[model samples]
Target: MTPSEYGFLKQFLKSRSGLVLSDEKQYLVESRLVPVTRRTGHKNLSALIADLGPRGSEDLKNTVVEAMTTNESFFFRDKTPFDHFRNTMLPNLLEGRRSQKRIRIWCAAASTGQEPYSLGMCLQEDRHKTAGFRFEILGTDISTEVLEKARTGVYSQFEVQRGLPIQMLLKYFTQQGELWQVSPELRAMVQWRKLNLLENFSHLGTYDIIYCRNVLIYFDQDTKRDVLQRLAKQIPEDGYLVLGAAETVVGLSDAFEPVPQHRGLYRPRKQGAAASPRLGSAFPTLKAMNS
Candidate 1:
């Protein structure tokens, strides 16, 4: 892609959805968007962008953008967070939110739906604890197509094995030909929707726990800070925010501090702790929302 072409597409993408494509990822732009050429009846990449330049239908524009949005995800991608959630966080959050008897979990970048469903499956391990609570595992992503797959709760064997444990797999998934489908019970736990973190998610309100993992690394520092601040507004003081282990709120935003229980997991500061965001509205304190 030429610099001029890159600039045009970058602006279009950022405007439609808060995605930033660095120059180094120029190849990614070409490789991903090539499919759009064939789909849109264009002979090549340049033609696809050129044809879409004027009077492109809303659906076509959306298809182009959705194609650009990365939807790579696997069962548990990173093992540590699930481990932390299961052994430490879930126990604490369940204990703290015990009286409320309800919990809301948001998986911010729930690409193709595996992460949130994985959380649901992990929670499935302890059914008794969740007996009285209202558990709603909300999964959101910027890409509508991926959101659709998440709602379906079906997966191929390769998809199921990515981060799933064998025992859990046997317990919660069923084999149908070559594909593995998650039990309806686990699938029913999550609700899917389209949400962009770059935009204000304040309307969604506070959540006991949020999983916005692994998606921040692609953003510029300013964008990271803004998104984190906005996320803080929808969370309460005791709320838990989990980011990718490689990612951090450390110089990005001062709203949260790493929890001692799980080194990478964080809790929001009270009204005047350190550089906590003034707009902080933590939904609830959760040692873990395992149930």
Candidate 2:
């Protein structure tokens, strides 16, 4: 692809998906869009780029945006976030929402449903403690393709082996030919939707916990701050926001404050005052159970 075409693609992706492609990522763009060219009969990346503006095919524009959005995910990815979920987040919500008897969670960047499903598995294991509570999980992604795969709840042998415990695999999934499918019950726990974080998402309503992990790394500082502030609106002051280990709110926005010792966990800051103190983060991770 020519430099001009690459530049147009970079801007197109930024406006459409809040993705920021640096100069060094020209090769990355070329590599990721090659399949789009073959599938759509565009002949080359430049041809695809030419067809992407207001006069271009809307379907092609969406396809290109989806192609550029990264959807890498696995069960209990990064380990520590799930550890915070099971050990810290869940317990707090269970107590805080006892009167309401219902708790909502949003996996803001859910890709192929691993993160939401992992939370479902955690809820299942704690059934004895949460006997009478109702849990609602919403998993949204920009890629309809990944959402479709998530709805099907199927994973290949290699996919399941990554960070997925053998015991949980045996308990929650059934071997279907070469792939494993999560139980219908577990799949039903998460509702999937196609969403672009850059657009308005207030209609989806509030949640007790929101996991917007790994996705912010792709956004420039301005876009990151915009997304983070919007995300803060969907969470109540007492609610939680979980970001990737590499992402943080300290430098960008003060809408949230880090939970003590929990690396990737943050709770919404109270308006006009500091965030409330929480219990210590000395809670043990689920390593033994997962192992």
Candidate 3:
């Protein structure tokens, strides 16, 4: 692809999906979109991109965006976030929301269901403690292809072996041919939807916890701040936000502040509040929560 075409693609992806491609990523773009060129019957990447110029169909644009969106995920991709969910987040929400007995979690950019499924498993294991509560997990992604796979709740042996424990896998999944499928009950716990973080999502309502891990690392600084601030609006003051270990709100937005001693955990900043609200009443220390 020419430098101009590559530049246009960079801007196009950023505008459509908040994906920032640096100058050195030209090869990456060619690698990912070449198949798209072939699928669209275009002779080359340049021809595929030319069609996107003045009269690009929304269908073509969406197809390109989905093709470029990464959907890499496995059960409990990183261990610490799930550890917090099982120990601190769950117990706290269980106590804080006792009157309502309902807790909603939004897994933004939740590619192929592993993270949400992991949470579902956590809730299932604590079923004895959460006798009267309702847990709603919404898993969303910009890619419909991944969402379809996630809805099936089926994983290949390699996918399952990535981060899933043997005991949990045996208890929650049944072998189907060479693949394993999540139990019907566990599959039902999560609702799947196609969502683009760059678009308005207020209609989805607020959540007690939002797991938006590993997605912001792809966004530019301005996009990161915009998305983070928007996310803050969907969380109540008592709610929490979990980000990827590599992402943080420190230099981005003050709408959230990191939970003391917790690396990837954050809580919404109450407007006009002088000091951060105390979580002692709701979110206990990890050690205390675990004990």
Displacement of the residue 147 alpha carbon in candidate 2, Å: 0.6
Model 2, CA-based lDDT: 0.90
* Number of the top lDDT candidate: 2
Better of 1 and 3 by lDDT: 3
Against the hidden reference, what TM-scores do the models get?
0.88, 0.96, 0.93
For model 2, name the residue pairs that clash: none
RMSD of each: 5.1, 1.6, 2.9
Q: Tens digit of lDDT per residue, candidate 1, span 1-291? A: 678888888888877777888878789889989878877787887777775676877888888889988888998767667776666556666767888887788999999998898788767766676677778889999888988888887788888878677777788888889988878988889988888787778888789889989888877788889888888887777678899878999988888887764656877866664533222122222223312
Which residue runs of candidate 1 sit more than 4 Å off their true CA positions? 51-55, 272-291
Better of 1 and 3 by TM-score: 3
Better of 2 and 3 by lDDT: 2
1 or 2, greater by lDDT: 2
**Cα lDDT of model 2 by residue, 1-291, tens digit:** 888888888899999999998999988888889999999998887788888978999889889888888989999899888888877888887778899999999999999989999999988887888889999999999988899999999999999998899999999999999999999999989999999999999999999999999999999999999989999999987788999989999899988899988899999888786866555344446796665
* TM-score, cand. 3 vs. native: 0.93
Model 2 regions more than 4 Å off: 280-284
Candidate 3 colliding pairs? none
lDDT of 3 by residue, 1-291 (tens): 888899899999999999999899888888989999888899999888988866888888988999889888998777778777766777777878989999999999889999999889878876888899988999999998899999999899999998888888899999999999999999999999999999999999999999999999999899999999999999987889999999999999989988877779999886686335333333333234223
